[model samples]
Target: MDEAVKFHFVVDGNDFTSAGQASVQIKKNLRQLGIAPEIIRKVSIAMYEGEINMVIHAGGGEADVLIYENRIEIILTDNGPGIANIDLAMQEGFSTAPDNIRSLGFGAGMGLPNMKRYTDAMQIDSTFGKGTRISMTVNL
Candidate 1:
């Protein structure tokens, strides 16, 4: 692509079955574009973890991915209750998800941490009653 390419996706919070659809699609699209396998894997994993967090806590969100020459940028935004503590939330096992949500095989509190683990850089902007936005980048 001559210019940066953008992809938008709407995450559905009601259904767990469809939570990771966007990430999967992103992976496929990158593959078709001949993106490096390592870069694609890292971005896809980070995006998938972010998507699951939106479903498990935020009730839904919007994800925008920008594909550029040397990097991929992912921005995930949601209108759910904002995270109360970024520092605490980054801990490996910290979680605020309901017990019911935990039972569904999520809420391990690994979402943000895992996202960071896979991406080169990540930042979270959140307000108590407003919402949250996370920006993550995976260098190509």
Candidate 2:
């Protein structure tokens, strides 16, 4: 693509049923754009994890996907209590999800780690009481 294509989605924090919808839509869009399956998978996984995090912790958020000729960028923004420790949060099996969320099998503390694993690059910006913004990119 000569110019970047963008897609925006609003996640509903009140409804767990709506989580992951943005990633699913992004996957379909990538497939339709003829992007490689592997790249699409990476983007989907990373974005899905971010989406779930927004729902479970951030009271929902906005996800924006930018499709470029050489890469794809996923931006997740939320206005919720920010992560206290980035290092600890990045560790596998480390989660702050509530018991109810865990009972539903949603929080395994693998969200950030898996997001990093699947994406080529990921960055997180958060403020303890303010909010968080995560940006991830996948090479095409």
Clashes (backbone N, CA, C under 3 Å), per candidate, total 0, 0
Per-candidate TM-scores read 0.95, 0.97
Q: Evaluate model 1: give its lDDT.
A: 0.92
Q: Supply candidate 2's per-residue lDDT for 98.
A: 92
Which lDDT values do the candidates have, in the order given? 0.92, 0.93
Task: Look at candidate 1 and tell me the lDDT of residue 103.
Answer: 88
Q: For candidate 1, which ten residues in a row score worst on lDDT? A: 1-10
User: Which 10-residue window in model 2 sums to the lowest lDDT?
Assistant: 1-10
* 1-140: candidate 2 lDDT, tens digit per residue: 27989999999998887798888999999999999999989999999999899999989999999988898999999999999999999999999999998888978999999999999999999999999999999988
